[model samples]
Target: MRASVSTVQDLGMPAIYLHLLAELLNTIGVDERALLLRVGLDPARLKSTDLRVSQAQASEFVTRAIIESGEPGLGIMLARELKLPLHGALGTAVMSSRSLDEALELMTRYLTLRAPHLEVSRREEGDNVLFNVSCSMDLGPLQGFIMDAMLFGCVSMGTQLTGSPVPGAAILRRGPEPGYFHRFRQHIQVPVRYESREDALLIPRANLKLPVRFSDAQLSASSRAKCEEALKQLTEDAGFACRVRRVIETSHPFPPKLARVAATLFVSERTLKRRLQEENASFQNLVDHVRLERAGELLKNTGMNLSQIADVLGYADAANFTRAFKRWTGTSPSHYRSQALQPIKPQASSMRATA
Candidate 1:
């Protein structure tokens, strides 16, 4: 999908991951320059892990890569190459953790710095620990690829930390099994079950206590502090509108009320409104913007009908959603989804040249 103006200004991905994708594409005989151009990304500006690109740009690039390379297992391939250092501070924190359990805890806490669209939670199921994965946004066609990379990347990184295979760790994918499922077994070296009820990792509790190969107490403390500080800076750098937009986009009930959003942000409603005004935005505008983007995503990527989409977006009915969607894009959801089946021409104007 072509990114809307608000989407270009709001959602983003870490540049490091983009760089890794570029490297992989380059190795596979894809022209990195041409690929970046297709997504309106600038290679020169992506030199640092501190930089970021719009989520629209990242998702579009992956979509194009899959089409161009004819590789449905691209995410799994990329996950195989993911080393701990590539994750920045979160990587360091994981590497320095006292044990695998602590490392997983740090990953749960700081994963958003790398992937803002995912939510990670840990629960105890008898003697096993379940690390559940949930998405905050509809990932469109990129859902399977992204999830594969993330879940497999977790396994790869865990192995790197403990310096051996993570015994009894198995993957549970909610979607249908891919034809190239062996790629997962090759990299993760563990049992994987697709068509499960949830996307999670079933980790044996005994393995959680395994000592990290690079366990450094002092470095772990320092790295965690750095991660916290960096997270604060990252939020501040996103500016007021983008920050509020993220909060709204990730809310569980879709478009949460202004007061609820304010509470989540730890500010009074009056203060939240005032800050938004300072940024030349309003809560309603951000809410509508998020709803419109999410509506477009679900329409394009999922089989959920208009009524289901309406319920997900907090609309009274499909009729109301249809009206709002037409107001946003001058087309009905059905027409939009039909058009989305066709390949979209890459637009240079869809992304900023520099973040």
Candidate 2:
């Protein structure tokens, strides 16, 4: 089955994914809230079901979580926790869907709402249907984790939706098996093959007709409508500018050069500039946007000195950084830091009554 995907690459990822990761970390004695704060993510923001964290922040936080927890298999662990309801509208739609195939169709169409970096395609090989999962961007070291979560998450989804594992279903991976996977192998219900050409889920063709345990026609209709609107809005908002911003957000050496960014995106400098101009944006503006965002994160979250912060943000010296920060926010960096870091106060009326 071939489905058209209407989405932008790396636009943003649902906050629920990260929020769930935090919860999983907490179970293992990691201070999830402090970890989120250290990554410049406000702990309160993840509470919103509709909220999305930028790809850069998400990448950084996940990387840090894996490193700090020393759990390279965190992806599979997290997959184990992905209950249907936790997936928002997509989950609802899948739950209410008529059969396994119908739910997969919805996922193929609306996957961008959850993980914008991935796309799914379906193919038939003998008696099995392969759901090929591919990354649309260069995810760096994070690719393995993302792939694990996605492929295994599908296995989890099948078991939840069908009330049991789909008959004769298996998983395919592109690389050799990791040592850590041996620890989790006993718990996994489905067979997983490694060193394949791609990451995919293989299920018997007969399994597609397995009816969902809790199918509801009216609920499925409503949820699919919601998914459509979300897809439309996400596609409209994700333009060349958004892609450029993503590149800027994840680049190393603080701010990246234009040529480097263009090359990373597989475009020439002139084409990159022209595309941004079409979207009423410029390369420098996108860079500045990411720089200012990181600057604020560093100022509020870390105690780095002005010189250190300057160098981190690609400025020649503290003086230049101070000038740029003032220009961006109309306040000196020191003053802004004081204001941002200050504790909130109670209302004057409440204070007076207490007094």
Candidate 3:
């Protein structure tokens, strides 16, 4: 089956970051709107604060942006523009944190909410504490761009939060230096080392005690709470089975074929099956779950008959739909609908009424 761009699920980087990237592309005369549209993304929709673009689409857009602008340092440039507040809840939490260490810890724990592909870990080396940056997946060609954004973005945000250059701070990159880094070297506050063992931000232990410019105990607590909720939702949605279920739920044709769904997600049939199996799920089960949920809604809320509901649910006929519904709920669809439609009576309280 040919992949349909419209069927791709939205479960990746925040749209606000993409909006920022678009603005950057425009400044460089790259026709950002066209570029986004070329990849099936709506330019206006990218402005939403709570929207997410599909990982496949985002990957394609960034790849194209790099090729079109002839600048491989786009991620580094984008990092310079990523102000703290622009990061949403995570940003607010970090800004209001009591100390630089607290802020880093907040980011380490909640980075998945903003960028699901990256993770931050801490290590001690002499007087410096290394906040290592690593990709949670195989990012392929985008590794350099993502690393530049994450590591450099951390450096920029650190300085912004503390209101000064962090003492004894530097960036360590794993591979030989990219030629593009030199272009932005003068603008960067800290020295950067290449051919290092890991991509990390090296900061002195003393720097961790530095006070944040916007520290607020109350706001930090509130913002951290929001970040916690966002992380939970992101983790739940990050599951392969959950992602497949979402695709099934939103599919236009209803109960899309396994082949088409695999295509839409940019994976082969075998790979999709394997991934779902790893999560102890099957495509048929996900589709059936969605069908059952929709069936309940239709049966209870709509006046449509069983045949109409069956057709809407991709069932061959009412008999098959009825049989399936019975197998699932141990009752006939008509009986369930009748029960759902019956008026409810308030039950008397178990406790005695007050005089």
Error of 2 at 52 (Å): 0.6
C-alpha TM-scores of all predictions? 0.66, 0.68, 0.69
Name the lDDT of candidate 2.
0.82
Task: Please write out the lDDT profile of model 3 over residues 1-355, one tens digit for every residue.
Answer: 4223334334577888888999999999999988876766667557767767667667888999999999999999999999998899999999999999999999999988788777789999898899999876666778999999998998999999999889899999999998887789999999999999999999999889999989999999999999999878877676777766655654546667788678757789999899988887788877877777778878987899999999999999999999888877767889988888443221233111121
Candidate with best TM-score? 3
Candidate 3 stretches with Cα past 4 Å from truth are: 1-11, 239-264, 267-355
| lDDT (C-alpha, whole model) for all candidates | 0.78, 0.82, 0.82
C-alpha lDDT of residue 208 in model 2: 96
Candidate 1 lDDT over residue span 111-133, tens digit each:
87888778899999899999999
Off by over 4 Å in 2: 1-9, 239-355
- Evaluated at residue 2, the lDDT of candidate 3 is 26
Clashing pairs in 3: none
